[model samples]
Target: MRRLGSALLAVGMLVGCGPGTQAETPPESAPSAEQQQQAPILTTTNVDVAIECSGILEFANTASYTLLDRYLPSNVVTNIVNRRATAPFTSLADLSSVPLVGPTRLKQLEGGARTMDFIDADCVGILDGIAISRDDQTAIVNLVNTIDDSELHDVLPDAWNGAVNLLNTRPFTTAQQIADTAGIGDVSFRNIRNSATLSRPLEALFTAINAIPSNGSYGATTLRHFDWWNIASANHYYRDQKECFGLEPTSVPYGASIRPNLANAAEVRAEVQRAFDYVGGNTKVSAAVRDAGFANLDALIQGRSFKGCILTYENDPWSRNTVHIYVDTVNGFSVMTETWWAE
Candidate 1:
């Protein structure tokens, strides 16, 4: 809610003053006689100054994606794109007749389209905590609340009322009111309030920040840490683990295993062979073949047994990546580390 100031004055001139209108006229002696003698007397007319309130001003971030998904279903969107590529619609009616589209839906879609074409089209200005149109200088602030009902009743509908409420009733102004109505105290209300008073667009900036990963090594992981390559790598490991050993992380207890103890070297070698074969045979191993190799290099030094082995690959090098494959005497197979390089 940035604030701007405006002044409106309606200037008019009083014509002839009759007997009954004498009281309304300024005293002749108050100013110059010449001024009073003027046929049209100057008078100030008070006009109610209204400020236009727009929903666009209220949006902490644009709702372009939301509007797109709502109005343009997948099929409709695909059809529209295809139509645009092949041939343009001759009329609005032809465009509206697309499948999964009705009059109401079409109107919403058109509004969104217009908003996209002219960035400021959807913006409505608010004056005195209410939405007002500049053309008629009429306040539609209260009408904003009825937007939902209007949609159902086939009237002029506003989809931005929720956005308006979010702006006007932001936590800064309405926190105390909300707490009071909800039978809570000011301290509690203040604790949960998310109203930001930053002069810039903090919310949109934060959204961008949240999308990137905090890890410096990886380019950028998602909030879910399911980056494209990570997902592909995980799927590869998951498929091999399931098919070769008939085992899954969820099915096996942490301290238990399919086999009671480590089998003989020959049996371990067979399992290692199976793992290598599985990885090698899979043509869709995302990285280079050299990057996908796995090996078991366990050996005994002195009397101590070296049970775990490192699976190294050229692309996923020791400097940047490490994959630790362990064979527990008690728990059989365990993947200790599967990490990627910083590049």
Candidate 2:
């Protein structure tokens, strides 16, 4: 009876352990959509490893300079480091041409060592626009917003007043009326008017006057009427003319104590005719002629120089016909009259 009972129990246990008797299959681990989408494809350590390995592979080419340094032998962990000991790398190209670093190694190095944290730290902001080449040193920094003419007057009111005052005091016979109409101030206008006969250009005289700040050191009087008018006018009018005529206008010699002798009206007229004749014949005088004219005028003045010549000529645009006046000191003439009629 006992043996028969043992046999039945063993059979029962084996029957319970059959294939279908295990717990219902763990519901098939099916990853959720979000988990699959957000999983990190690569780790930071993996990236670092890749870059280091690639750098080692491309050591012969890209890192020739670093390889030649003292740290290379001690730092290199590879057993094949002795192979590079005889690297006859005189130049970067020679190092790159080594057969050990082939295309496959080059590609690996390019991809892995494209960016390294240690190397990148040194390169931060290296490629900014502020770092210009030496040749581009004079490049102008363009202003985003430019000042308007109207705003300029408001910004520099004193300069405007100085300019107006200077203009008002100029010594033309019609200056007072012009000044009055132009709405120049009394005190400022009077000062300029009194000083106008000093024979300097109005602008230069003003510049000299204005150079004395409201509270500043005074200097010796240097600007004169001739300095103001003839010299100054020549400077102003001939600026554009100099470029057109290919002549260089020089600065006025203030230290020279020379006065221009006034040429008679007849001689002045003849000179004017000569200029007109040259212009009329050539249609345009060469730069050489213009330069010669300056020299001739200087010689004619004998230290004293006038601004312009005064003479009447035929009225035609094509024909150079107008009155030229020598207003500056070299010529006795003090007036320049020009008349133009629109056809």
Clashes of 1: 8
Query: What tens digits encode model 2's per-residue C-alpha lDDT throughout 139-253?
Result: 1111001222322222223446544433444433333232343434433332222222212232232233324322222121211122122332242221112111111134222
lDDT for 324 (candidate 2):
40
Clash count in backbone of candidate 2: 21
Residue 238 lDDT, candidate 1, scale 0-100? 18
Q: Each model's TM-score?
A: 0.17, 0.17
Model 2 TM-score is 0.17
lDDT scores of the candidates, listed in order: 0.28, 0.28
Regions of candidate 2 where Cα sits further than 4 Å from its true position: 1-260, 281-325, 328-343
